[model samples]
Each structure stands twice: as structure tokens, then as C-alpha cells.
Target: MSDKRTVLVVEDEEMLLSAVSMEFEDAGYDVLCAGTAEQAYDLLRARPRVDLLFTDIRLPGQLDGWDLAERARALQPDLPVIYVTGYSNEQPRQVAESVLVMKPYRMSAIIDVARRLGVG
Candidate 1:
């Protein structure tokens, strides 16, 4: 068993997902990538634990980031969540104890939040 903490990153945009995943990886976390909320849900179900969830507000399929966070919280009640979105005007229905970060955020900022959340 590795000591490295894990983070599940959900983003529909392939490039953004890749970039974010790489940043997390570089920051010494076990990075899991999902292109949609459904896929992220599946990963959450399959994995025993995930240290953090960094997701985009807008996503394809039946669930959005808010929906995914709700479902994930059901599975892991204390899971740390960070919601990222390009649309600042979108009214956020965020979960408790979670952070909402706007688009064009610095990777370091995200990593710092994860660390503060006790992830890495």
C-alpha cells in the first residue's frame, strides 16, 4: 500500500483534465481522471478511498459536479470536495465544507487546498 494520497479529478474537457491530473501527479498525489460525473461516480464506487475530489461544475451525462459531490458524499461522508467552474455567473449549489474555485485557477492553488484538506 502506497502512502501517497489520491485525488479524483472530473472534467469534461480532455485537455483541462489532462493538465490538472498532471499537476496533481506532479504534486505527489495519486491522480484519478474522469471525463464525466458518471465515470467519477464509478471510480468512487470502485475505489475504497479517495482523498479529494476536484470537479468541474458543468459536465455531460446525467450528473453535474454538484450531483457528483452529493453522491460521493453519500459514499464517503467526509470526503473533501472542490468545485471548479468556468461560468462564474452560475449559481452554485455547493456541498458543506467544500471549496468553489473559478476557472483559470492556478494549479498551485488547487494543490494547496488539497493539502489543507489533509489530502497531500
Candidate 2:
């Protein structure tokens, strides 16, 4: 496996996915892009070395970000996660303390959070 820290970015929107992937890459992380929950799962299953997971709260398929986070946590408890959302609705109480980044966040903010979490 490569030595660089790997970050998995899960977002359904093509443009947003590309943008976030670029942001993480620019911040000196090895980025893994997944457009759906299933793809994220596949990536995680196939590549267990991922250090960070950045997922959108509202995904396109049957499995949402919360579900994906739970599953990923089960697979690798040490993995850090950051959830991104645009809505103001109540988030899941179980993972309330998990890192969250509001939509339209700046690259610096994302990098700061990743640094704080010791992921970058």
C-alpha cells in the first residue's frame, strides 16, 4: 500500500464530487472519490487503508451518509469521518458529535478540520 494518507470523498453530485476531491488533493491527501454509498462501500471493502471519510449527508441512493458512516465505522473504528450537508434539519443523535462541514465551505475550512482531526 502507498504511504500517503488516504481520504475517501463520497458525494453524488458530479461537480461537487470533483471539487471536493480536488480540495483534498490540494491539501496533500491521497483522495478516493465515490459518487454513491455502494461505491463508497466497495472502496472501503477493497481498500482498508483509508484514513478519512468525507461524505454528504443526503446521498442519491437507498443508503444515506449516516448509513454509510455506521457501516464504515463498523469496518474500521479508527477511521475519521466528516459529514457535509446543506440542509438545516436535525441530524442523527447517535453521530451528533461527528465532524460536520456546511455546504459551500471553503477549502481552508476543510483543511483546518482535517488537520484538527489529525487526518491531514
Candidate 3:
């Protein structure tokens, strides 16, 4: 596997996902993107070296972001996950403790968390 840090961005918004993917790529980290939980799971299963996962709480389909986080954790015990959402109250208790970032966040905040998680 490559030594470069990889981040899996699971988001439903097309523009936001593209922007975030660009940001992370510009910062020199490898990025994997998925629009739904099933896509994310497929990427995870196909690529086992993902270092961090950034997912939004509100997502389409039955799984949603919280479910994705739980399932991702089960698959990769030590994988660090950062949850992003505009709907604060809807976030699950289990995911509340993990790194929760509000939408419209500054790039600095994302970069800081990525660094802390050891992702470039």
C-alpha cells in the first residue's frame, strides 16, 4: 500500500463533495469520495487503506451517515471518523462524541482536524 494518507469523504451534496475533494487533494492527501453509504462501503471494501472517513450526518437512503460510521468502524476498528452536518439535533449519541464538524466550516478547521487525525 502507498504511504500517503487517504481520506474517504462520504457526502451527498455534489458541489460540496467536489470542493472538499479538491481541498484535500490540494493539501496532498489521497481522497476517495462516495455519495451514499453503499458507495462508501464499496470503496472501503475495495480499498482497505483508507486512513480517515469524513461523512455528513444527513444522507440519502436507509443507512445515513451515522449508520455508515458504525459500519465503517466495525470494518476498520481504528479508522478515525469525522462527522459533518447542518442538522445538529439529528446526530446520534454514538457519533456525537466523535469529531463533529458543522457545515460551512472553515478550511482551517478541516485541515486542523485532518492533521490531528494524522491525515494530510
Candidate with best lDDT: 1
lDDT tens digits, residues 1-120, model 1?
Answer: 989989999999999999999999999988999999999999999999999999999999999999999999999999999999989776789989899998889999999988887778
Ranking by TM-score: 1, 2, 3
Clashing pairs in 1: none
Model 2 quality (TM-score):
0.92
For residues 44-66, could you state the per-residue lDDT of candidate 3 as single tens digits?
Answer: 98875788889988888888888
- Give the higher-lDDT candidate: 2 or 3: 2
In model 1, which regions exceed 4 Å deviation?
none
Distance (Å) between predicted and true CA of 116, model 1? Answer: 1.7
Report lDDT (Cα) of residue 45, candidate 2: 93
- Model 3: CA > 4 A from native: 95-97
